[model samples]
Target: MKRGVLLVAHGTRVPAGVLAATCFAEGVANRLKAQNPLWENVLCRLAFLEISTPDIYAVATQMYQQEGIRELYILPLLLLSAGHALADLPRIIDDIQRDCPHLRVRMSSPLNDHERLVKIYQQHIHDALQQESGIDALLFVNRGSSYPHSYRIFQQIVQQTSASFPDLKKTSAFFAGLGAGLSRAFHRLEKSGVRECLVLPHLLFPGRLSAQLDRQLKEWAMGHAHLHFRSAPLLGESDELMDVYAKQIVLFSLRRAVQTV
Candidate 1:
């Protein structure tokens, strides 16, 4: 059966957000085709959940009709397995399956819970910190979710990061809620006599939220004599992240094939 990969992301109402995710998905498809000649004939497409162009079902149906694709892998580009990943996405997949009963559609896990993500996070922090000196604390900021499991996992990852870099003081903060906001988190860190602070976003791509965070950081930095803060680059089209995406698709394919037989 002919197979295809659909990268699904929770797109943004902001134009730049949509463009960033779309560019990343295109890069992923190109990387896969370059590494594996077998993927050349396979259809790779991008779909969005909301606040963007080409909703999930529409894109899937179009690929099915145009490409005669039998097997479809829906890979979500979400960071954590939250409402969108767990509830919304599966409902869409089920709706698509009901409409096209003959189509073999499988929904894979989101980018959450992947160890390889740590490497990407590490690289972001490493690069951002290179330009600064006397960094006493590092704060990794993430778009917070209501899900408890996801939050717990995030905390564990933060602890792991702290352990990895023993020289710097590391902690994780949230932008949405709980405790202090991003700026307040930095204030607390600064009160503890930290010389320099760096914030790394756990988001996969730059979006409206990321832009807001950037602005807040800038405003917070004004007249802060003792402490300096910087925001790391949002996840973009990189070789490491692309490899993770490709491997995830291949692994999902194998698992689905095994389940069928």
Candidate 2:
């Protein structure tokens, strides 16, 4: 069977965001190619759900018609199992299945609540701080979702992260939905006598939201020189993350093979 891998990301208006996603997909494809000969023949393509062109359906159709790919696997590059993962993605997949009945397609779960991801965040925080001591609080900023479960998972992650560093005081805020916004969270922290803060954005890639947050933090920092503020980089391209994707693909393929047998 001619196999293809379609990586789906929540598209962003920022050109850099699109480039980052593309780079990540390319890196994963290269890693998969080198790791196993079975993936040598597999084609890898990138697609977006919104604010970007050439969506999943378009890419899958191209692979089927032009590349003669009969089997396709979709991997969502989302960090949480929010509305997009729970509803929008499934609806799109159903449409694709109806459109291409001959193609065998499978979609794995998102990268939410994954142990590796938590480890990655921890590493990022440690690396970003880099011996900076006397931090009053660690503020985690997340792109909030309307789904209650998403908020629950986000809180769980915060709790886990806080547990990892019992010495540092950790708090969380959202970019959109429930709880306080960035400004409000920071204000509360300031009121509580937090003079030094380490802000970590729980985002996959640098996008509009990340850029906005960076701008806000910079402005806030400039205004309040007394309050030391630092922001960590987003979770960009990494070998370990690519390995996760490759493992998911391999596992899904094995399960599919068993079901076929």
What tens-digit string does per-residue lDDT give for candidate 1 at 1-261? 988899998888878778888888988888778877878778899999988889999999887887888788888887777888878987888888877777888887876435777777777667766777666788888888878887877877777766667888876778774434676687787778887887777787767788888887777777676777776677665568877787777777776632221
- TM-score of model number 1: 0.91
> In model 2, which range of ten residues has the least summed lDDT?
252-261
List candidate 2 stretches off by more than 4 Å. 256-261
Q: Estimate the TM-score of every prediction.
A: 0.91, 0.91
Q: Please list all clashing residue pairs in model 1, or write none if there are none.
A: none
lDDT of each: 0.78, 0.81
**Model 1 regions more than 4 Å off:** 177-180, 257-261
